[model samples]
Target chain A: MKRKITLKQIAKELDVSISTVSKALRNSVEISEDTRLKVQAFAKLYNYRPNNIALSLKNRKSNTIGIIIPEIVHHFFSKVITGIELVANKRGYNVIVGLSNESFDKEVINMQMLANGSIDGFILSIAKETLQQQDYHHFKETINQGMPIVMFDRVINEIPCDKVIVDDVRGSRKAVEKLINNGCKTIGIITTKDYVSVGKLRTQGYLEALEDHKIEAESSLILKVDDKLLSENHLESLENEISNLFETNPKIDGIFAVNELYAVTAIKVARKFGLEIPKSLQVISFTDGVLSKHSMPSLTTVSQHGQKIGEKAADLLINRLEQEEAIEEGEEVFETVVIETELIERESTK
Target chain B: MKRKITLKQIAKELDVSISTVSKALRNSVEISEDTRLKVQAFAKLYNYRPNNIALSLKNRKSNTIGIIIPEIVHHFFSKVITGIELVANKRGYNVIVGLSNESFDKEVINMQMLANGSIDGFILSIAKETLQQQDYHHFKETINQGMPIVMFDRVINEIPCDKVIVDDVRGSRKAVEKLINNGCKTIGIITTKDYVSVGKLRTQGYLEALEDHKIEAESSLILKVDDKLLSENHLESLENEISNLFETNPKIDGIFAVNELYAVTAIKVARKFGLEIPKSLQVISFTDGVLSKHSMPSLTTVSQHGQKIGEKAADLLINRLEQEEAIEEGEEVFETVVIETELIERESTK
Candidate 1:
């Protein structure tokens, strides 16, 4: 769908910073008269619509921060929420949560419900359905109406806002490299469909590591799991798919799964195939969940530090909310923070 | 804290139901004029304050439900929240969550923040600290101010409102009975301090089960872990405590732990003592969490069915809220629903 040019785009065309374009469009006293007039003319030419940030800021502050997550029964999201709660409570701000359940409509409804004078700003992770649809009109409308949003984990590059994200590519690359250093020849990856940004990045990292070691990437060794298997009700199907991967590739020696459920399921399937873990089959997954620590042979994992991501996201949002209060209307600068992931080795890998 | 007599107390004194007293106090058309005068005179004599239900209901509806959980990183609570979200969304209501982190002060603050006209009703589980302190003024104030509350899991029996709770005593008794039937002698129990109502009831059930089976209840076999060990940061201390339990009672062949964390820790400690699971030692836990399902020797658990509990609580709260709308002022009737627990047999038990 065609959309109006954003402040970032207007600034890029006029060879100025986004802040300058914003000030010029709003006719701020800080902007030089010549640059202001030129920027305004260019913005008009492109039919740019100014964000009503000032109008939102004028509304009564709720002293509460809203967080919308994709799932509530997930450990990673839970840890992030705990971290946000800790920071929010300490800073005299209360935290409230909304679950999108990975639906685009729910995400939009949740945001509108909380943003309707219930919270000062938002700290959220994008829903999988939203990412897949590529429809960000609701998010755009909220931002345009002057409400600030700080996104974490799953974010859109096109949405100009503060974001905190894990280095998924580097994290998964390290997991694959660890398997390589342990002398595993046949490496397999169990991941989600490419629409999930993290899964896509992790898949990319697995390919890059194989390329770095001059190993040929084979389609037969990779399994893109259908998300329906994640419901835990269809864990049998997930196991069957993994079993198929092993059956098709008898030489499979190493595995990297994107999440805990997939990693543990892979282990169960490997054991059924009479393969001893860390001896014949080495495995690693990206998320450090409880299942990874307590599984039969345990699992090696890339720790995304969900708590740190939440803390950083909360800090960024609260800082912006407070800064806007102090400076009234100033230059709008957004920051994208990349949180480093760590590899935690356990019995799964040799 | 000294408090004003409630409608419940007046009803109890006058040998009438709580709803009758509530109706009479409000001088409702449904109540007989004589009964209304008698109830009103008694209320005046006792300095009773009528709940501001009408005033609260008169305000614009937020169409949002507020849920305050003691902890956010718990699997049971997470499942419960998922159930609440499922029902709330379908009923055209949005759900928001607040974490008290088991702190009384935080619980009060969360209630106050959400109660400030942000939500129509609340569904909460009591915090550990609030239970310890026995300070219920916050809850009383909210109820008095006329917002409906639905409580689940950890709830106060004294609080008169809708409640959905697992049959803790019966559930724990069944868990103990399972060990007895498994042909294991010298059964041990890992539980929490008695300040927590659930823990107290669970301990009582343990004693009752032993008595019913003609086995002597040994005080030495019971280990009440400090609440601090639940932080996960102090997991080492929890393991050490379980280790000491085994070292001092080497004859302990069976164990019933109140929660998944304690049960998993027991398994780890037993392994260190060179005891194989379900071979020499059998264990059963109350909560069926992720740890129980994925542990090396998967645990046998009495499932509390948290999601079912949440769904019930949501239905009860929403029903009352909607019912109130039909009748401008009506008799208030509260309910307590008990969700049954099921025993899931796994590798940990014979």
Candidate 2:
């Protein structure tokens, strides 16, 4: 029922450096007998067990980092990988990528496979299934075993580790505000179900923007698309759902989509209904990916700068891996770095 | 310089199983004295030196397969990875992906890094720079060191190994023939330079299609885009080049692009010239990726089935890895699998 205590926490409470605590716990002759006994007693009281994997860290140095992502076909995840590799390779570390296909079991299997002395650490994004199930034992177990993990983009707060994320709420708010600035009297927003962290944050931002503009948020104009619609087989149904939204709300003059697919789909459906883009229905979307750039009347978008996020995540992970010198153990500090997003203006907006 | 002989070749020449030849060469007591002498003499005659890494293979049983790719952001490569992971995970193997970023040095480094007891074998796509430089020493050296390799998509025939490829020439011919069947005259084909094997084959297919139709291939209508044009900073120049082709050959009614980017770019340029898709200017491209599907007119394309290629490549590599019962060394056979392509009709063409 209680949170697991770490070596850093024990060291901090004892007013000792992490290495001194480690040496004391290991009963190194370099540490005095009195200090060793005290450290061991403290460790036992807190049910602290030395990480199994950490004990072998000194013997195996692969100089390689493993990255496990939810999906390989995604534009944002790929960019993050490119960024991670650029930094990792330059720092004399090779990167090994594993795809979980958005499954919780696959995610756990990949982490375990990589952790078998093949990689020094990991940089990962949580899978949707894992998030939906609210299960993070795999992440906690890996960290407990002394392998550092730096999560990015799709991360859960339940795990105690470093994270790098974009300001999704702020980015979405800016997009909605831009639509309002374009003199749109009525607006619509399309997003994924609330289980997706980024989608939920973006949806909240949409509501906040409406409130700020004194425009009552219309529930009818907000569509929470089923994730299944994003797959290749259900594209027609996806179009139908978006089409139904437009047919039901004829006065919705502007749109904000949490991701590129929805934004492009809305454009296609709007054009089908004989609506002219920019002139009749301006739109803004998240993720400045290939779709946003290549879509006709190229989309105006909130660019997540995925590569930068990758770079930050890799830096956080590699720094932890190379921190041979034990920390001051001041509450075992963890960082959650937020990379700012940029609104890229294009032909889809006035 | 003479080519180094492999264990399979030695085994074949000695008329023994590959395992027997291996055991004999290692001076195992299980092999009869006569057989050991015969295998050893045959190996020495062919100047066979046991691969350094192969000797250590027995000590390391990391059930992970390493894959090195040219670019991770590419749609084709990503799909290939997805397929590979699906098959590998199912077969109780884990895939570790390494990106070469199309650099020859990075390719060599990634291979070397993985070969140091981190993985059982490698599945790789050769980097463009490696092919352009015509330096395959790294591949030859790796193979000589007794590690099995399975190359996919962009591969070199000089390396004696298993390969999985689409029928590029056939696929291209089909796409071009389809455009010709629609009564397109003065067709333009946008492609990469001849150094890229896929583009070169596709371009040859276009030429063959024109020859079959009794239409002399117009050199002016064929645009061999510089590889640099694909980068973000030079995309405008790429567009300009395509526009110039249209400007000079106003009567060109169809376009067969070797890849999705060129096909989509052509559509954008055609629209700029007030040409309507399908009705006035038909387009067909290779690679049924996101861009092809989501483009305004939805491109008609030759589906390469990248995932299938990945699956086949993984099967080939894993089989080699698990071939503990060495073959009856009659001959070391290698297979080049050609996965068929299908032309999917969409709005870009009639």
Candidate 3:
């Protein structure tokens, strides 16, 4: 309430060195009992708070982490942010969030802004554009500067860092196996772009599973939609694509949409064609969301365990940050944390 | 290549003031052209960077805003956050996110942490627990300390601040009016705890609409679920509640769920009872999410324009921060923006 007090003033009042006062204020064990007690009392009297940034400069640890997310509007990424914050906050680390807006340039700039002593490390999910570009020199630069990074979903394979990812491939494979088990032989795959590592992995897993079930993977049955084709006018293009796929391969009895949005779209397209779900065209999808639960037949899906993925990713990054000194040389593969994707059989697959 | 140089060190070497160097570094037009050129040459030569945090402190503006969201995993809040970030980032403000995890204490602690010069101001949606408690003295304290707060969605009526909110009452009323127009006499409501301001407003709006249509509002038709019930055994309790509501009020031909989750649940329960959506019982809900889009009949909803709300809130706060003087005194109302809701007529209501 009175004049603002500084560590120098406290040091003078206590007749001790500035470092000793600073150390005592930080609760350092190096300060003696009497000095610590006096310094603590004086600090309490003045309500002294050491400048965090200045202290960080001296210690060379910012105690802050930067997080780059593709989009906060997405439920999956938002859950991941929650997980990261829970762990980071518990460990007394502040988190700075930057949105890439699915742009590579934005993502790079976001990383560059905090690369110099602003943040100790980074935890990120790559933007769709960044995945498409496949240039990870910005991440590499941070690694060269001895900063730890932990990547979650939508990660790049080229960058060497600690990674926390869901077993998308395995999850997709399991979905295909389930479809085959349910007497669905000709499965139609509805997906948007193969640019992402996750997308590629999911597609490959689908193919592998089909092969294992003695079903030849047909390229014509794969109905691919570009990311740009989600707009209003693009709906016609999507409808045409679906119609063409059906025309070419009329035996398709099952459909698997890689993402939930596309899955819902698949359901709509199927309905337009007067396809009776489960009876005529069984529907299965990757990544569970609100839409899947509400879809006409209440979509059967391979749940990605979004919350778990987020929690695990946060745990991995915080764990690495805590053990920064003893961190290993190579990339820490977090087991691809294959949290089993449960088949939530609702009306769609019944 | 030699040693990393700082702004202060460079200022000393060039015999120029630190303020001048800082202004030049930012390319501020306040400095002379020759001096600015010299500062730029030296800064580039030595790779000098003034500490962003320290500079921010000196200017009394951090170019950062603290955002406390209840839960980002929810689509509505996630969309709101995305909107806030889009506007804030474009205006050159970094957003620091904190998840309240729906706890009052955690929310209070986050407010306290950011109050002490950590961020320029705060943008928040009250936690569910906070709404239930209705205590906002901590927020008042921050405001008293000259920190601006812009609250969106879940906001307290008592707190005098800039607020961005959806017209829940009006939206609900219009929804019921539409149901009435569709030939529904008896309407039931499924909602979260009535303690939240939004929930109460929606219920009131429903009552108003029912009265307007000459339909009697019955207490037996309302089902209120608390947080504990929500976290543990929601589906079972909700299912039981819906069955009981229908049994007691068998004449009920319409249902209004105050949120997307409840709306989705209503669709599931309706299907179990062999009731055709929109044909036998017209259904409408608030808070458009992935679930609503995927619900069996594809729900007709009172879409709370979260993106618009978020953008408006961010703009309000940024405007206040950018202007040297206060914009307005006493609760700056953002005019409860009522974005039109579309009735997505699918199998349920069509």
Best by TM-score: 3
DockQ values per model: 0.15, 0.16, 0.37
Model 2: number of backbone collisions: 0
- Candidate 1, A1-350: lDDT as tens digits: 12235788888888999899888877899999999999988877754553222222334565678899998788899999988988887786777778888989989888866665667789999998999899999887677656789999999889979999999999999999999999999999999989898999999999999999999999999899878324656777888889999999999999999999889888878888999999999999999988887666778999999999988988999998888778866768899999999999899998
Residue-level lDDT tens digits of model 2 in A1-350: 12235679998999998998989988899999988999999988865654322333444555778899998898999999999988897787877778888888989888877765567789999888888999999897777656789999888887899999999999999999999999998999999889999899999989999899999998899999888434666778778989999999999899999988889999999998889999999999999999999879899999999999999999998888777335533355689999999999999999
User: What's chain A's TM-score in each predicted model?
Assistant: 0.82, 0.82, 0.85
The residue ranges of model 3 lying beyond 4 angstroms of the native Cα positions read: A1-60, A234-236, A325-346, B1-5, B8-50, B324-350
For model 2, chain A alone compared with the true chain A gives a TM-score of 0.82
Model 2: which residue pairs collide?
A: none
Across B23-72, the per-residue lDDT of candidate 3 in tens digits comes to 98888999999999999999987656555665554665668889998877
- As a whole number from 0 to 100, the lDDT of residue A120 in candidate 1 is 78
Per-residue CA lDDT of model 2 for B7-122, tens digit only, reads 88887877889999989998999999999999989887754655322332344445678899998888999999999988988897777778888889989888876665566778
Error of 3 at B329 (Å): 10
Give candidate 1 regions above 4 Å deviation: A1-59, A229-233, A326-331, B1-60, B229-233, B325-331
TM-scores of the candidates are 0.80, 0.83, 0.87
Residue A282 alpha-carbon offset, candidate 2, angstroms: 0.8
C-alpha DockQ for predicted model 2: 0.16
Evaluated at residue A286, the lDDT of candidate 1 is 90
Q: Identify the superior model by lDDT, candidate 1 or candidate 2.
A: 2
Order of candidate numbers by lDDT, starting with the best = 2, 1, 3
Best of the candidates, lDDT: 2
